[model samples]
Target: MKKRKIFFVTGARSEYDIMHPVLEQLQDSGEIDLQLVVTGAHLSETFGKTVRNIERDGFKIADRIYNLLSTEDKVGRIAGLGSQVTALAHTFNREKPDIIVVVGDREEAISVSLTAAYLSIPVAHLAGGDIANDGNIDNSVRYAATKFAHIHFTFLEQHAQVLKMLGEDEYRIFNTGNPALDKFIHCPRMEKKAVQPLIEFNIQDEPYIVLIQHPIITEVENAGDQIKETLEAVIASGLKCFVNYPNSDAGNFAIIENINAYATKYPDVFHLFKNLDRVNYINLLRYASCLIGNSSSGILEAPSIGLPVVNIGSRQRDRYSAGNVIYTGYDREEITAAIKKSVFDEKYRAEVKAIRNPYGNGDSASRISDVLKTIALDDKLIYKNITYKVF
Candidate 1:
């Protein structure tokens, strides 16, 4: 019997981490020939050249697509998408994999799904049907991927129901939960003493905050001002902040500029990083007093460890969150008060600790792996139909 060829596309550190567990499962299945197509920020030095992280994890890269543009604005993002579509179409044509797997709503997801649809290859989309009406282009991109995708693996039952409403066939949709949590649950926790050397901060001696705010595409011009508000709030709270750089999105240059200025101005309390490995990042979340930012980690992964999150602004506005998040706008005072409540309120902390993560049971990788191995590859899977039903 010939092994099934499964090709996975990863564009950013966050997307790669989310898909790592499933990638591991597929590689270990013995029934799969896994191909990894690395692209976007993974190949860019400005984003830490995270392709090395994948290589360090010991996965053989099938190909690398260097499609990230030097410009950091809306025009650059669209141009990068066009580059990805062109490059990925040629790659998929040459490789001819049994299926193409993509995660989340980034440009990579749409690029791969769109290319695979044109090539008559099945595309499996993870984290589809999850709503984040954050006024960013992400929501539209995610929903568009859903229409092109042949199989849907969502993070929640609610998200699966969303696929149903979107006219996706129920049999093709699986509520496999978030694969990122699988890694979070299984990765060995790093002690504060060990974490100190990695972060260069004495987390054991004082409470610290993990900050990861990304720029919203719709509000590109104000990205610098928006991050300044977050910086002011975090600084005013007087907590040592371990800040992460934003993703490779439009307006990220402004956000990075503000973050750099703040870090230089307050060297003692502000620390900035391009990226951190998954284990170190998870452990940082484990020991932080609170997480302050608009990154989806605040919405998806933070709750599992009972970390209090002060989610500032609309990047994650309508996303479903566990009981651990406190939503606030871009106002400095409002963000400061939320940070205070998250970090200092013992009662709120206790309540947050007691709330279970609604995402999944950390077995999503196994479930997704099983489907990929067993699902039949035929015309039925390639040709999709809208499953409209009377409600």
Candidate 2:
């Protein structure tokens, strides 16, 4: 029997974190050949050189296409997509795989999916049908990928409904939950003693909040002001804050500059990191008083750990909200109050503790693998038939 080959393309640490389990499952099956393509922020030194994390996990990368640009502006993003399209076209032509698996709505994923569509290769997209109303380019890019994709794996039923409404065949859409949860559900929490040596600062006896705020592409100009507001709130709260750098987006330079200035001014209160291994990151979330940020990690993963989240701004605006998440505007007072409520309000804390993660069960990777094992790779599957409805 011929081994089925699936090319999995990952661009950033966040997407790679979720794709790890599914990659492992496919490799372990002994029936599927996993061709891993590493690109985007993973290769950049500024982003913690997270490709090292993949290597440490003992997976061989089939290719490392240099698709990311040093510039993070509007023009740079368009150039980056062009580079990815050219690189991926060559990659698919040279190493023909039966299927292409892409997750999320990042530029890399959208580029790869669009390239595959032109190449007539079947593209399977994960985490589709979610909404981000913050005017992030990802929303429109995500829908475009869904339209081109042959299969869709959504984390929630609502997302699946949205996908169907967008004209994807219901039979080809699978609600496999969020694969990012698989690691959190299966991996044991890192010991505090072990985690201490991994991070730059020691964990305080007092509770701390894990903060990860990124620039909203649409509101790129306000990125600095937003970070400043969040920084002031963290300082005023008098709580120890463990913060990660913002992602490589249009206005990231402003966010990075603000982070650097904060670390210089409040060295003791804020512990900054470029990246933390998945286990240690989850461990931080597990022990944090509350997860504070506009990051999807707070909305998707924190609730599963029974952590309260103070989600700032509209970056994650229409993604499903758990009772654990307190949405606030990007004002210093609003952010500070949200943190205080997340930490000291007993009634709110109780509500958060009782909330369930709407994402999924722990077995999402296995379900995705099962679908891959049996999915037929043929003209019938590669060619998408748009479902039309008269509403």
Instruction: Point to the candidate with the largest lDDT.
Output: 1
- In candidate 2, the residue pairs with backbone N, CA or C atoms under 3 Å apart (3 or more residues apart, or in different chains) clash, namely none
User: All predictions: root-mean-square deviation over Cα?
Assistant: 1.2, 1.3
Lowest lDDT sum, 10 consecutive residues, model 1, at 199-208
- Residue 37, candidate 1: Cα error in Å is 0.4
Q: Which 10 consecutive residues of model 2 have the lowest summed lDDT?
A: 196-205
Stretches of candidate 2 exceeding 4 Å from the true structure: 389-391
Which residue segments of model 1 deviate by more than 4 Å? 389-391
Task: Give the alpha carbon lDDT tens digit for every residue of 194-290 in model 2.
Answer: 7777786767468788889988878888999999999999999999899898888888889899889998999998888999988889887887889
The deviation in Å at residue 331 for candidate 1 is 1.1
